[model samples]
Target: MTVPTEEVAGAGAPEPSAQPWWRSAVVYAVYPTSFADGNGDRIGDLRGLRERLDYIAGLGADAIWLCPWNPSPMADGGYDVSDYCDINPMLGTLEEARALIEDVHAHGMRLIVDLVANHTSNEHPWFRAALAAPVGSPERERYLFRDGRGAHGELPPNAWISAFGDSGWTRVTEPDGTPGQWYFHTFAPEQPDLDWSREQVRADFDAIMRFWFDLGVDGLRVDAAPAMAKEPGLPDYDLTSYGDPTVFRSSVWVDSPQWDTPGIHEIMRRFRSVAREYGEDRMFVAEAVVSSSQRLADYVRPDELNTAFNFQFLKEPWGPGLRDVIDETLRLHAEVGAPPTWCLSSHDEIRLATRLGRTDTTAVHLVDPATAPTDLELASIFHRSGEWVSLASLPGSWA
Candidate 1:
């Protein structure tokens, strides 16, 4: 859908850097709620974001990866997008979004927004239509809806486990009020995985890309990038097998039945093509939590994404473990000729400051701020901020 906006001219921005903007750029991730409150509503909005552009620019950021500003149920922190083209009413309006884009570019920085491609909010229009449609209908095919394995359809279709620690499949009630098919969700049940095998699903994403690019977004950060494609036949997977890191393939999700499955590269290539149509510098940075360095590199092959989050590096504790990961990452990415990407924090993961103070440093899950260690300390236990900055001095770092 075309996101309507009045004429908003790009401000007088500086020339592009000698290198690709993202290569040596510090892409700042801005979560909307607490960044600033422009309307005195105690929540962040585009107006607030604009007001702080000078402050952000002062920090020497090269781009802003605005965390999900799309209309959503707030499940998964706005990753459950209900409308891909429009801004969340709480955050701002379409016009404000346009102005924010212009403001961002005007400051000589690019804007990257989230593309929750692997799934949609359960309340999405297409998903609601799918729920209303009968089994075996085309609407149902747009998502991963399958009949239950049991005789009365009482059980989940497979034993697939969600990252949030529940059955990946959720059984739904039919329109006639009967027990019905189970739908897949890699995260919360509020977000249902889209069936990329469906052409309409893929096409809609292509349209979504153009809509944002037209609005002047410089790139897209693909949410749940690995889980886009799944193994065929909805087969049950051996959960125990996943614990053996050595056994995992270069794709990370090969034979896993869900993440980074066989056809994900093709889907990413399709996404890349869409971005390329806009411009070569219009790029994609995948949020890929893969099994190994090789798997991470595979996601950023030239034909696929321009870069992917170096999650292994993020999850490593300081010292030998961290060094090994960096070495391995550089080696693998060098092979693919893709610039390695690194990040300190992400919407889905714990902040670097908090994680650094934790006893179990490499654990990547988000913990309640109160329950987790307090902010990064200057004590003997925690590594200082300067160390981290120096370590991440190379290109493709996100803050």
Candidate 2:
């Protein structure tokens, strides 16, 4: 299985010292909602994060990738951003966020925040204006709002499914309480997908990037990076024809007009330029959930994002499958001269220990909520020295 090098050829190389700090850094992902609750509000806030900075620094993590702390409605676990510039009041004020950054820097650790460019909360001012505006109005153009299919315009515009297991299109209610056009949402309906084809959308993201970068954010972890750019003209797809729809490896998922399109690379390149304007140390990492190693590598090319999460490694089972994914990830990243990121678990994923102790370890285990091991089973795995050694071997870093 020979890997192609054309995608990386002639890519402008940065000087070794100018390389982003994330290349060999251990970045600990912090879910701010649960990390700690400093104000006794039963919800974690910037104060909590600030209080725990020492613990994170002591853990030897070079940086901390914070999940969305931006003002959100808590829909989709804070992925539905309502305001890009302000911090969530429930989380803390903007002053606290700034102080957290200063504290992180004081602890000798860098800070990166999640950037959800693919979608925005339904409560966002732009989206609210879009709901009131007539179809084809300038406000509507900010999102992927389109006329529904069928004679009565009752059917969805396309056969696309949401990542959360439902139709991707959500019909809106017009100001006069009439049925309205449907809008695309890759995730939940509250999180409507933005129409990246619009220059205004691109410009808005550029401002959002600068807003954080200028405030001293070290990096951004772009959420749903690949889905930002969709193939023109939403098309119907046959989900049944693809084997194992649950696995991203299925052709239905990979070849869909909705994901990993070539246009997304250009969008990423533009984002790369924005990061470059900040300094060599500023970085962008993509959360592109494609199944192919080559497709994943494309996201981290020299002129694109600095790195991307290796979901292939995250979803692989123990033994040969895991080893093969690690090896291929290292090789593919090497071809692009990019570093690979590794993780056993994330806020959206089950804990690493529980996942490894289960009898069936596959992507299916993740989707099936009931597949978790019993308490005794988990205890047994923890008590075994051999299991501990095997679990330790599962963590892989960039070579």
Candidate 3:
């Protein structure tokens, strides 16, 4: 498990200035709702973001990575987008959104909108159409709908578990008013996973990418990047080996049937090609929780994505030991000629201050993994071949 720092010095890696602006830019991430409030509604909106443009510029941010601002049920903090072409009513109209993007650029900063292509809100028009269309209709092909197993089709089609700790397969009642087929979702039931294998899904996603890139979005922060593609046939697994399915983000890592599958690279390549249409500066950064450093590197190959969040870095203990993570991360990204993005915290992670308080100076520090729930699965990512690392040793290791 020891990483040779000499072989991968300055794991902080290269000077990517010769590349796109986004390569070395200091991106200030904003969870729109709490960033600022406009019009006194107490929820952040595009108008508010525009108003803070100067303030963000003052902080030296080269870009703004805005979390989901599209129409949603707020089921997963706006990640469950019901519509990709418009803004949420609560967030402001499309016109205001355009104004914000303009303002962001005016301040010499780029805008990276969060895109949840992996799944759509159940309320999305396509999903609604899929629901009303017959089980085997063209509409159903847009989603991962399959007939359930067992007598009367009462069981899930597979044994996959959701990231939210439940069965990934949810049975849908037929339009004819009887118990029927199942649809898969990696998160909440409000979100339905898209069938990336289907032509309609791929075509629609390309259009969605164009819709935003045409509006001058510099890049996209791809949510659930490792998902969207699943192992074909959706095979069953012996869940016990991966640990508790109820553990948050801890299940389905090793030989997972739901994520980081072979087909995801092709999907990324397709999306990367779309980003390329907007020129070299228009990039994509993946939020992929993969099993290994090599797998993480694959997300940013020449024809895939531009960059990806080094989430595994957050799992390393503070101080000297943290160098291994930095070296490994920088080494992988360096090998692929892609710059890596690093951060202590993101919208989804626990704040840094709280994580630091749990560790001591001497000996091995028992930080987040020691104090938090056992099912936090970052442990599996660091699991090297023929080595069994304990879940309690990793720091801040959840998805």
Candidate 4:
């Protein structure tokens, strides 16, 4: 996994002025569960991550961005956070997390943790109270809880679809054992969306930021950054452009009532101010998937996030289309005075080699190993092996 120092330095050289370390630093995204299993329970923990600091440092990475390690129900792979201030016992303890942070700094590498502010696990205390409280109570106001439509309240509040291919609204059973109000879940029902409109929600996240920063964390990667804000009215989407069976279909409409609204920018501005309070070196990166490059740039405005994931590059084919995206991304990011962050693959997406070796690159769908055709020639050419290897082996070996 060692990267050539010359290449790393050239690719991540900061400008000759006072600039944040994140502006020009190679960051490795670590999905903790599978990164390294230190406890021998077959689950990666803080000890495992600490043990791998040398390995990551050897790879010439300037920082490591860890996926959510907070206490969670594991319903959405730890993205359904139950506690923002504590470490998941299954992963490790809060002391171990602090030790890992110090250990990472000892190796001269920064640590950026995933901040899942958009949602919380249904099992979270806030969500639990929301469920127990009567509809329209303050506890319910912390989350997006709305009464269902139609007679007998049998229908979802709106036709918004979850990212996981189901209705975004999940009905809860009242204390009397009857169907109650529906709660919004942008991703999975187990992860209910938090109402960012609540002042307490904003203040709570600000405190979370301070807690992590005070713990020696270098930065935060905001999860579901764009969906944090919704339009004033919970409006039904016009599914005409989304095509039939639009449950999991990608929405091209950036102005949708549920996605990329102006309120998100204000939230980002607040987050940016919080990060600055710790130090100018502390940073925030947005995981926003918007319609256009300009829309992506909006997340990294001078007063907003430090940078955003350039997802267009990951979806583009290796041809003129890729070049066009890169050119546009550079131009758009420059216009906003932010560097373009490129990623070929991610934990949520298919492996880069697999995507590049596929015959139909434009499909943009998750690869189903059971039904996908193996491009033996392409795989051999790209990976230099006839046998398919795991993502861990492919990149390390190729490098």
Local accuracy by lDDT, each model: 0.79, 0.79, 0.76, 0.79
- Which parts of model 4 are misplaced by more than 4 Å? 1-17, 358-399
- In terms of lDDT, the poorest run of 10 residues in model 3 is 7-16
State TM-scores per candidate: 0.88, 0.87, 0.85, 0.87
Off by over 4 Å in 2: 1-19, 244-252, 358-399
* Ranking according to lDDT, highest score first: 1, 4, 2, 3
lDDT score, candidate 3, position 122:
95
The alpha-carbon lDDT assigned to residue 283 of candidate 4 equals 85
Q: Put the candidates in TM-score order, highest first.
A: 1, 4, 2, 3
lDDT of 4 by residue, 1-399 (tens): 333333222212222225667777777889998899889999888889898899988876777889999998799889999999999898899889888877887777778899999999999999999889997799999999999999989899999888887689999999889999999998999999999999999999999998887777888999989899998878876867656645554325655888888899999999998877755677888888777888899999999999887777666655667789878988888888888886656787766667656655443333334444346565555564333223223211111
As a whole number from 0 to 100, the lDDT of residue 84 in candidate 2 is: 98
Worst 10-residue lDDT window for candidate 4 reads 390-399
> Which runs of model 1 end up more than 4 angstroms from their true locations?
1-18, 243-254, 358-389
User: What's the C-alpha lDDT at position 142 in model 3?
Assistant: 92
Kindly give the stretch of ten consecutive residues in candidate 2 with the minimal lDDT sum. Answer: 7-16
